[model samples]
Target: MVDYKLELIILPVSDVAAAKAFYDKLDWRLDVDIQGEGGFRAVHYTPTGSHASIIISNGLTDAAPGSTRGTYLVVDDIEVARADIASRGIEITEVFHEAQGGIPSVNKEGRTPGLAPERASYFSFAIFSDPEGNEFILQEITTRLPGRV
Candidate 1:
């Protein structure tokens, strides 16, 4: 069997500089920034403790800016992560757990207030978005499901 790994994700942004600034504020590691001929430019950033990195560039895809959503970043502690991000001046949604149905709803309506009562991994989450409206969810996951690792 072939091994597959997710290394990069391309994010569309209306302004490259603005996006760069936003990610910088989040304290993500700036991996590279390259400019090429014909108005080409690429910027790569990796969040702290994340193996996968995100690429922001021009002339790479036709996707509209801010159209990307639901990207997730897993953490061991949702409250600490949320507070850290919020301390950086980023606005974050309140922490929420999955509703009684065992699946997160499509929007805020499906979320119940506060953390998961059982402290279940992958059950708690908080949401935030970049300046371009690219949404990201921070999920608390202290353990992985069987074979996930």
Candidate 2:
């Protein structure tokens, strides 16, 4: 069987330079920035240790600016990751877990302050947003369950 690996995500941005500055502040590695003819531009960045990367570009997609939501980043330590991200001049939400052990919903109704009871893996979370309001969730998972990689 051929293996299909997820590689890059394209994010639509009204201003490429502003998006570049925002990701730069997070210290994500800057992979490339290109400006082509007819004002087309693309900037790529990858989070440290992540195989997948993202592109914030002009003339790449027709999606609205900041339309994406609920993108998640897995972490082994929620507090440490959240703290480090917050210390980088990012405004992040307090740590929260799904209520009654439910999955995190699109809205804020299911969230409860602080980590999950017993600090269970995959239950604790924190949230942050990019300059254009793209939401990202940092989920704490000390151990993976079953076949998750």
Q: Cα lDDT of all candidates, in order? A: 0.87, 0.88
Q: In order, what is each prediction's RMSD in angstroms?
A: 1.5, 1.2
TM-score of 1: 0.93
- For this target, which candidate reaches the highest lDDT against the unseen true structure? 2
Angstrom error of the Cα, residue 74, model 1: value is 0.5
Decoy 2 TM-score against native: 0.94
Steric clash pairs (candidate 1)? none
Instruction: Compose the digit string of candidate 2's lDDT tens values, residues 125-147.
Output: 99898888778889999989999
lDDT of 2: 0.88
Tens digits of lDDT, candidate 1, 20-99: 88899998999999888987778999989989999887757899987778889999999999999999999998999878
TM-score of each: 0.93, 0.94
Off by over 4 Å in 2: none
Error of 1 at 57 (Å): 2.1
Candidate 1 Cα misplacement greater than 4 A, ranges: 101-103
